[model samples]
Target: MTRSTTDEAAVPPLPSPKERRRLREAKSLSEKEVAAAVGVTRATVRSWETGRASPRGRKRALYAKLIAPEPAVKPPAVKPSVVKPPAVTPEAGAAAVPEAAAAAVPEAPDLPVAPPVPEAPPAAPPADPPPAPAPAPNSDTRSGAEAPDERRVSPAEAFDELYARTAPGLVRQTYLLTGRRALARESVERAFELAWQRWPEVAVDRDPAGWVRAAAYEYAMSPWHRLRRTHRQPDAPPTEPGKRALFDALLDLPPAYRRTLLLYDGVGLDLPETAAETEASTPAAAGRLMTARAAVAERLPELADAAPAEQSALLHDRIGGLARAEHVPVPRPARAVRTGSENKARLWTRAAVAGVALLIAVTGLTLHTAPTHYEQPISPPERVGGVPPRGGPQKLTAQDLKLQKSLSEQLAHGPERLVPQLE
Candidate 1:
């Protein structure tokens, strides 16, 4: 294929100052690096990055394309090695260095084939893994027969395959942590959904499945759903009363111990991994695991699954069987956004209702039992211009009223008439 003369002659469009700066910063490139990569001076690069100037012509388009995606990681620092040649004498170096570099480059036709030569060696090792990588390959193998056929999987396909194999196990592990099958199922689904979204990164992980399991466990352990609930009746009772009681006993453990217990015995992670999952030291995890087992044994001695020093596989089997036997229905797969939103809504609603009820209760109590200190205001006794008013006579006397008829004349003239002569 060939470009037309007109197409070749046409100039690429210029990029804006802001666009240039954004791309440069996104790729984490210094002005010097960007300038060198795009074949420009450092001053010009500074002008572009600072929004004082914009890159034009083909270079501007090239710069935009360069920073469109994340920059690739820089190569690891080279290690010191015995095989590396010592520095040569100046005379020998001048003659040999150029000749060696030139000889190292294969012919133009052989250039493409050379890459495959190195790739072929690493590719075959997956089928026949080195002894150092034995444990990993074994765990990844679906079966003895499938181990030979196990090949490199694309990110999407690897994530799907991992989810299918590990989801049930993750659900069971979460059930041990949360004490609810529905919660376990929801947690597992959310974890895998995350794995799917981040498959490109997760696929290259050393233990992608472990990463997802840890995430699921964390999701199940959220306090919102637990706090919003008052008391929940399980969908199905455990086949045995002992098992049910034991499960409740598990809930009583501190979160650290509970998580360590499950990560070690329920999920079958090694002590170091369990510690990592629980954010504890290896010795601390071991201690917690031992203490949890002892606690469980003390709580329910008859439970073989909880017996001290019982194998993890047996615990897994017993718990798995019990979980299934007690399951009434399969819960729908969970969405992270939906679960989080619903939990927050439930918590807020419960809190608001409780607050209103408490306020009403306090008000009613206050109204019913008025304080003795609160009394009616009374006016003091009446005063008569600074003297207290006296009470009137209780009964009336006969002499107090005047007679309607005049007194008899003989009685009236006897004493009083003599006094008038003196006046």
Candidate 2:
């Protein structure tokens, strides 16, 4: 009992519930793994994390050590050893002195003759101070090794590394987001392309993977996908009944609830992180998580029998398995993605310039063709003066025609007839 108490005292108190979860995640450990390490059921671990329950005795100490390992104690500095000269009695001092030096000393009757000691050999230079202990590797340093050449990596190389590391898992996550494999692959590709385009911003971000993940999730969950002819029909459900049921249940959920579930349960993110990623309040995220889980359980009778914590673990495994079962096409290479992004940017820029030029030309043409001043429109033709209509020509009477003929004959008869006619 005394030893146990001493051990407990030596162990530091565990961090808050949230912090415990964070430390576990920071180490990339899942609750099941932690539970196994702590020798407890997974549910106990969950309860401990939620603060509904606490571990005691050996379990508490073990759990504390697992989640938050105590920092290594630094070794004490090596102090230089000081060599003190041995004290000598009077006789020893006289012996240490040479006979000649002792003889040269003046004899005094009252005070014993003082013996002169030869000057001590110059003290050996203090041994070189022990080389300072190599600076203890920082606890934060990866694998307790010096920082790697990654610091000198070029932007493209870094981007490629990020892509290769995350693209597969992202593709799977996207598959969960959208049931359609094709859309999932497309969304992941598009997300990486955007990341490549904005590499400068992404490279400096605290969580570059999260940045890409958010982009991918946003793309996968877009309501606009409903408008697409290809996406209008659902893809064939998974062949296995269990997978099919889980996939269908996930699809039935609201996008936000589904996302929260996936991030927290499936991706192993903390509640605050899930809420942040989903852009919901903590309570709201928790509520959604509960609702989503309950819905899944209701649909699948098998899960209904299990406790909530176990249910969550099952869901996580199922979702992961389902995602993996689908043959997600491998993501395009990072170099290819970067090249495509650059090409797209160039194309868009050219298109924008051309559009501006076209707009300018159109504006100029409109200016040239537009009337400078409003002109009164010409009026349609109308009769302004009142005039009587002329009657159609009437046929000349027969007698008038004969008189005309006789006049023409008399005129033909003589020039005198023509002169009379003129008068």
Model 2 has how many clashing residue pairs? 0
Backbone clash pairs in model 1 (N, Cα, C under 3 Å; residues 3+ apart or in different chains), count: 0
Give the Cα lDDT of each candidate: 0.62, 0.80
For 340-400, candidate 1 gives per-residue lDDT tens digits of 5456667889999999999999999998898868688898897458766688966645653
What's model 1's lDDT at 155? 57
lDDT of 1 at 299: 70
189 Cα displacement, candidate 1 (Å):
1.3
* Candidate 2 lDDT over residue span 1-423, tens digit each: 699888767665876565576677778787789999989998888778766799988888889888875588999977765454445456544437555544444455655544344553433445565585665654454665647653557898899899989999998888887877788888988998899888887886658898789889999889999999988766888899888888899989999999998998899887877865775556789999999999999878978999988988888888888888977778778888889889998999999999999999999999999999999999899876788778897888999899988898774544444344554
Off by over 4 Å in 1: 1-152, 227-236, 302-308, 311-317, 328-423
Instruction: Report model 2's TM-score to 2 decimal places.
Output: 0.57
RMSD of 2: 17.8
TM-score of each: 0.41, 0.57
Superposed Cα deviation of residue 135, candidate 1 (Å) = 18
